[model samples]
Target: MSYGDDSKKKRRLAVIGVSSLLLVAMVVAVTVGVGLNNDSNENVNDSSHKSTSQVSPTVKAVKAICQPTDYRKTCEENLQKAAGNTTDPKELIKIAFKVAEKHINEASKKSKLLEELSKDPRTRGALQSCKELMSMSVGELRQSLNKVTDFDLSELEKLMEDVKTWLSASITYQETCLDGFENTTTNAGKEMKKGLKVSMELSANLLGIVSGLSSAIPSMEAFSRRRLLQDDLPVLGHGDQFPTWADFGTRRLLAAHVSKIRADIVVAKDGSGDFSTIREALPHIPHKNTKPFVLYIKEGIYHEYIEFNRSMTNLVVIGDGKEKTRITGNRNFVDGINTYHTPTVGK
Candidate 1:
C-alpha cells in the first residue's frame, strides 16, 4: 500500500474506534434511565402502601374526644405547636386557650346542626344524639381547661365567651324540650315526654362537667346559683349521693317530725300501708323544702317504678340494697315500643 493510502486507512480506523465508544456511552445512558424510572415507580407504590397501612392522626384525634379520657396530652402537644410555646405553662395555657376556642367554635357548628335537624323530622333523633356527643366534647374541653395552670387572661376570656355562648344555646334547647314534653297529652306523647325528661335530666347533670374556677362563665354562674338553692332545695330524684333510709329517717326523727322534718311529702315503708305506691305518693310529695322530700323505705320488696319531675330536684331514695329492697317492674321493648318509652315506668 502507498503511504497516503496507509495514512487514510489509519484515520478511518481511528474514526471507527471513536464511533464505537459513542455507541457504548449511549447504551449505558439508556440503561440508567430505565433503572431510574423503575425506582421512581417503586417509590410511588411504597407511598400508597404506607397510606393504606393505618388510620390518620386526624381520625384518631376526633375519636379520642368521644373516648373516656380527655386527651389532654394531645391537646397540649397540638397547642404547643400552634401557639409557639415550649416548657412554660404560659405556652400550654395559650395552646389550651386556642384549643378551647376551637372546641367552642365546633360546638357552635354542632348547635347549628342540631337546630337544622330539629326543623327536619328525619334528623331529630340524630340531632339529639349529636347533642349528647357534643355534651361529652364539652366535658373534654372543660377538662383541658382545668389542666391549664396559667394562661393569658385576655385570650382565656375570649375563649370563655365562646363557651358561654354555646352553653346559653344548650340551655335553651334543653328547656324547650322539657316544656314540649310537659305539655304533651296523648299516650305516645307521654312516652315521648319520658325520653325528653331523661334527656333533660342528663343535661342538668352535665352542668357539673364544666369547671368554673371564676365566674367569668355565665353557665358557671347558673350552676352556682342552682347549687346554692340546693341547700334549701327540694330533691327531684335525678340520682344524687345521700345517706340510706334508716340513717336519713333517724336523723329526721331526732330533728323533730312536725317541725324540723315538716316536709310536704315523705315516703317510707315503715309508714302506714307501705306509703301506697311510689306514683300515687309522688303527688302528695311537697315542693316546699330546700331538699327532696326524704323517702326512707325500710328494707323490703317495693314493687314499683319511680321518677322525678323536672322541678323535683331533691328526690332521695334510700334503698337497702340492689337485692334486699327492690323497686321491681318488668317492662321491655319487644312490646311494640322503645324500652325507654314507658308510661308507668314513666319518667
Candidate 2:
C-alpha cells in the first residue's frame, strides 16, 4: 500500500461516516413526525368523544317525555329545542305546551292564506271556518297557559279541572278545523289539512300530558271532604236525552230554560223585530264584542247567505229549530265560481 491507497481509504471512511450521520438524522425526523401525528389523532378522537359524551339534560328530558306521545319524533325534536337544558318535569311540560302553541299559531297563519287565495265561496267559507276554529284553539291554549301558570298543588282538583277543560277545548277546536276540510281535494286543501293535522297532534299530546298529570294527583281525604261539601251537585239525566258530547257551557245553553234568554238582535221575515235578514243584524253588532252577543232568528226560511267575519267575537245565533228557521242560498261551486266562495253560510 502506498500514500494514494492510504488517502483513498481515508476518503472512503469519511464518506461512510457522513452517510451514517445522514441516515440517523432521517430516522430521527421520521420517528418524531410519526409520534406528533399519532398525538394529534389521539387529541382529535378525545375531543370528539368528549363532545358526544355531554348529552344535554333537556334533550334527554324531551325524549323521555315525548316517548309515549302520538308524535314522538316531532314532539322530541321540537321540545328539545324549546327546553334547552331543563330536566324538571313541570318545566318540560310547560315547554311542550309552548311548542303546541307555536304549531297552532303557525297553522292559524297558514289557514288565513287559504281565505286570501280562495276563488270559490264554499272553499272560502270552509277556510274561514278553519281559521275560526284555529283562532278558538289559540284562545283555548292561551287560557290553558293561564291556568297552568296559576296551578296550585293545594287545590289540585280545581287546577286539574281547569287544565282538562282548556286542553280538551283546544283539541276539539283542531278537530273541528280538520272536519271543515273533510271533502276537499285541492292542493291548497291538502296542504291546509297536513298543517292542521300536525297542530292537532301536538294539541292532543299536550292534552294527554295534562290528563296524565291530573291522574297522578294523590286522592287525599281533604280532596274527598271538599268534594262532598261542594254545593253545586252533578246533574243526573236520562242517557238518551243528555248529549255526551256537549260541554258544561253548551249544556246550559241547550237547556229548555234558556229559551227565555233575551235576544241581542232579532231577525224576522215579517219585519216584527230589529232586522229582516241575519246579514243586516251582523253589522249592527259591535266589532270585537267581548260580551255574549245572541241573535234570535225567528221561524221562517230566509233565502239569503250569512257570514260571520273574524272581527266578531262571542256571537251566538239561536233559532226556533234547525228545519223551521232555515237559511238557503243559490251560490255553489258549479256556477263558475270557486266552491269556497259559493257557500250560503260563510265567514
Q: How much lDDT does candidate 1 score?
A: 0.43
lDDT of each: 0.43, 0.68
Question: Could you give candidate 1's per-residue lDDT for residues 1-347 as a string of tens digits?
Answer: 99999997886575445333332333344335544654667656987555533634333332222122134344434443454423232332334444544544454355445446354332343344334444544454454444333233323333344444444455454443333322223233233344344333323322322223223334233322333343463332224343222235444554453433443444456665346466777776565445446665545666777765534546555544567666777655334333233334443
**Residue 301, candidate 2: how far off, in angstroms?**
2.1
Q: What TM-score does model 1 achieve against the real structure?
A: 0.30
lDDT of 2: 0.68
Of candidate 1, the 10-residue stretch with the lowest lDDT total is 60-69
Name model 1 segments beyond 4 Å from true: 1-87, 90-123, 140-144, 147-266, 269-295, 299-317, 329-347
Error of 2 at 310 (Å): 7.4
Task: Give the clash count for each candidate.
Answer: 17, 14
lDDT tens digits by residue: candidate 2, 190-251: 77778877677888887766655555455333432343344344532334355443446656
**Highest TM-score model number:** 2
